[model samples]
Target: MAQKAPWKTNRRKLDITPLLVTNHCPDNIWPGISTQSGTGPGQNGFQLKPGETKNQTVSEDWQGRVWGRTNCSFNHDGTASASGQGKACLSGDCNGALNCRVGGDVPVSLAEFTLDAGDGHTYYDISLVDGYNVPMAIVLQPLENITLDDIPPNLTNPSCQGTDGLLAPQGYNPYPEYPDFLRTNTSYPLPFDQDVDENKISRWCPWDLQQTPPEKPGDGVYPYPDDNIQRPQFNPCYSACAKNNQPQDCCTGKYNSPSACKPSEYSKNVKSVCPDAYSFAFDDQTSTFIIPSGAGFEVVFCPGARSTTILSTSRAEMLQLSQQGKVDKQATIGLKRASASKLRRNAASTTFRLDRTLLTVTVVLTVVASVHVFC
Candidate 1:
């Protein structure tokens, strides 16, 4: 044998997928982007006007977060103000820059992604764990060969059932633990509650966690004293971690483990409203979603009663629900009340059985003692 040639192996290239962000809100919104892993696309931030849609691309192994910045006004040179008001975004401001070099400020509704995370799957979720600023949804775009059955159950679509008249689309599977308080508590403001005063009161966010406007007026960017502009008081809701910074709320220090750090009242309420989104740290079971990589996605702002064809449910039932409009308020309340009463009855029955068992044991002991005395 004169000579032997070395064998060569072929390496596969990573795929690039499209990410389309649509603004369905009435006003302008700036979509802020940040990369957490691998090589990012470098397109950090831009503005999307009402009804406008922007498209970006990401690598197969990319990991990042996207959020919307509301009521933003930047200088001609793309520099925002440092005053924390006006000339900057009311929520999700990236520290005086139109193009974010870092993650936006908290209380922003987050749509997070990690492509090719594990086992050739991509992971994503809508997170209100940091709190919520606007309604958002992450929908996997339909591909040529992929069908609803091919998609993973949790990875289909995660939409925030947020304020600003947003509702969970028909046939969308909500979190399993969706509480009845969301239906029966008259005090908990429903999305379609006509009596809600958006300007004066918070629609659904807790009063203590509501974000307040800047104390001083700005140079027309925010337009503080403009009576013509209708302002919403509860536009952004703050998380307990961001507002209080306690170890328990932030899941830090001794409360870092899942067992140690349980959901707070704030997290529970938020979870009830937006079950598809993460309500607190370590809320992985119900919030995180995973699917095989290689599909495009759409991030929709202010999604209304859109078709739930891509959801993991019957299309016909969804259509029927869409036609029926809002849920039956009276029926929902009655069902919740009945459920509570049944739980109470079960508890009482258990107590009664325990007492009867104890009485029988006492009588048996007394009879045994009398038999011994007679002998």
Candidate 2:
């Protein structure tokens, strides 16, 4: 053998597929609410205006969550205020930045996931153990050439039956405000507006939280009169950890283990509103789903929200509901679209892009208004 040449084979490049994250919220219904995710392009925060849809891309192994932040403010310096009232969010405050540089503060309705998270499956769940800020749903939008039959029965459809509202085109309107006593969501049978202990008054709980800077070195609350804006409320929605220093509720100490820790009263309260989501430390059987790779997703803010398509009932049905509720239908009254959009310190600089295709129409079909039944 004169010469034997050594052979070298080329190594194949690994294919890293991009995951498209398409998100949207109820059109024009929730203007103030902002949606966000972590360990991805969402570090700088993302907003989907009412009836708006925005798409972003992430990697296969990305570990993160999708949730909503309310009552947030940021300075032009990109630094949010302290105590989660100023620059940070009063609820779901993430690392105290307009841009979430780290995981968010607790008591959030988390859409937790580790994309393509080993075992050839995506581990995901909507957890309420930290507590809930807004109702969210992560929908796996079907794709071509993908066998979705393996998708667990629980993961096939949307999650969370969010608050219901109007059917536009024919007419979009709100029902009259009930009396304060009646308006109180604490009233049972259907305390839909109340979150658990009735502290979370709908999505816009307490309406306004105390930007009243943390009480120096004290645990009690402080009120402001000299400064009109910093007024504080007696009962505000606080996370489990904030409510109690108990290690179990905080998920600290030995209670960190699933078997060691148990669901608290707060978790049960949130579970009442969002049944499908993770209500506690070990709610895997009901809250989470494991799926094979390569699936597109749609995180709808108010999942199962009633809209025009589902509301197009016969006039007779509307009339009957109206008669039953004693609602006035003949007269057309006007109510300004409520804006939960808080007046942040950096109000001018914060911006969001709206998808025109989504903004243009409410739904495929048109229906007359029977505002009572829908709104």
Candidate 3:
């Protein structure tokens, strides 16, 4: 029997199928401040502008929305599948529930392709749904030569380099001319315009007023008893008594007693100032690609929050071997002869005619076989 041709010996084509699954949740949603009468300036009561003080009167509320997409493809077979989902918060804390909300009917798609040897390629595609009942649009575009390795990990670093080092520590309080007592040591400067002369005069006071006096004149209508009288009334001429006063009450005899300024201390509650913003880190370990061999493949886990259409083309391929009956050793010889004949016929076809050497050999052998049969 003639040797079996390599091309007809059940040769297989290289196959590659990529499965892409993606899930996304709202990182931050710009819920334009609630337009309710009492809501603050920005969306949901959060202010967008800097230096704007938030008064207790204004309230804020936020509602979040999510969207997402997935794609799968088989390059060798030219087949593809795509799906998408989207959702919005029904109620509750926007941030906490944005990820938990279930997605609505997602659109799905499939496509197949075939080629005519080398003349041209044929392709068929179908759109599963128009918008999949989702608010956002989902689009899928065909991609060429895209592989699983081509996808890159989500970048976590900020794009721009910081120039904070170049900035000088807020130069000595912009109002250095004002005494230290007049300026608050904070990013926010007191709104009051400081009058240096006025502050200097205000700093000096009759300390004795802060002390308890021996007695108070008796008055039947007085709110308190004379024995409860605080230090003697401010006396401008009693310089000797003022100078000899205790350290706590420096009775200068010049100005009225200084009342303790409302005690100002740092707030322990971090959430008080930035109620909406938070310090957190996120870990995105999602696989950009998947392999599907037996079980069905799903490209998207979190349907809401991501685009319905993937930014790039994706594919999934599956291969199934058939098991009809056990092979017989004697059938091998007949199979070889049948395969060689098929190869010879194939070589003569227009598709394989471009290989001049192969075509010439096939033709010569065919002619020799015919002549030998006749003899």
Candidate 4:
């Protein structure tokens, strides 16, 4: 048998859409403590500070962004489809007092043989929805040959690590043997050589450090006047499970939640210990590829305002073109112009005449021929 040329295989194009949203709010302020130790001079022997009566309202903005991608393949027989979706989210206060929460989800769908064009080309269509309440969406289309090697790897376990961990490496300096030490340090594992060609698969899970109980005043040096020696330190296991909304190990021997484990301290380490996971092709599997698909929308939020500006762009021109009558003429024209430029630059060596009449006639004939061949 003769070797086949790579270009001779069927070509496929993937389409994707993603959405994004953002919101902002102000910060909060609390009253300061009084410096006077004993009762102050007043009618009742304790006087209230002049300015302490009022409660100050600190304003803050909470901003969030969400997006998803979809992909589809084009069949020479006129039908085009593929399947892929990705989602990401970010939330935080504009004043920087509060920590940000980020998360991502990738959902995949597959379509079996739906259309067949014997011209060495098969068609698949994939669509994605962010499904979140935020005002954001994105679409992407990736073109490829129909060969099995052209399929991109799936992205699973997507995640986001907020800036809260900036102090983790230093603040949580326990030895590796400690469970909390492992939780803080065991970020997704990387290959020792950091080379894709390596065959080993590396993985890491978050662990928790064991909190040491505070020392009693009599057991150590004289405690400070304000020190609370008996104050309990938190237990790592109970703290972690609680913050995640998981079943608390409080009663179970396997996972115990002692009085020492404060919910506040437990919540502080959640994002740090739970970084996102990303899988990549090892060097040996470099033949793999990743194509993103989706329609994208940009929702910009102004300072101190709750409303935002929403703008949508094309993920695949075909999808946008299919919706021509539904969208504004200006949007359609812009998409058409952009699509024409992209096709000219990226399409295989074949030349497509774009003169209005000629292009319409050509497209009509191609569609008719495709229908007959597939039927």
Candidate lDDT values, in order: 0.57, 0.40, 0.19, 0.20
Per-residue lDDT of 172-219 in model 4, one digit per residue for the tens? 111222222111112211101111110111011122322222455634
Off by over 4 Å in 2: 1-39, 76-85, 149-154, 161-239, 256-259, 304-375
TM-score-better candidate, 3 vs 4: 4
The RMSD (Cα, Å) of candidate 4 is 29.7
Which pairs, if any, clash in model 2? 27-50, 27-51, 28-50, 32-341, 80-87, 81-87, 107-130
TM-score of 1: 0.63
Q: What is the lDDT, from 0 to 100, of the residue 298 in candidate 4?
A: 21
Question: What TM-score, computed on C-alpha atoms, does each candidate reach?
Answer: 0.63, 0.52, 0.13, 0.16
- Tell me how far the alpha carbon of residue 105 in candidate 3 is from the true structure, in angstroms, after superposition: 4.0
lDDT pick, better of 3 and 4? 4
Where is model 1 more than 4 Å wrong at Cα? 1-15, 82-87, 145-149, 152-155, 166-203, 213-234, 306-375
Clashes found in each candidate (C-alpha, N, C closer than 3 A) = 0, 7, 22, 73
Model 3 TM: 0.13
Per-residue lDDT for 1-375 in model 2, tens only?
001111211121323323332233333211121223323543336444444555555655666666665555556664656443543565566665755655556545566666554444555666666555455556554343123322222223334432323111111111111111111111110111112222232332222222222343333434343222232331124446544567887667898887887776655544554555565556555455544544455555543221211011122322322233111333111101111121121123334332222122232322233322111
Ten contiguous residues with the weakest lDDT in model 4 = 302-311
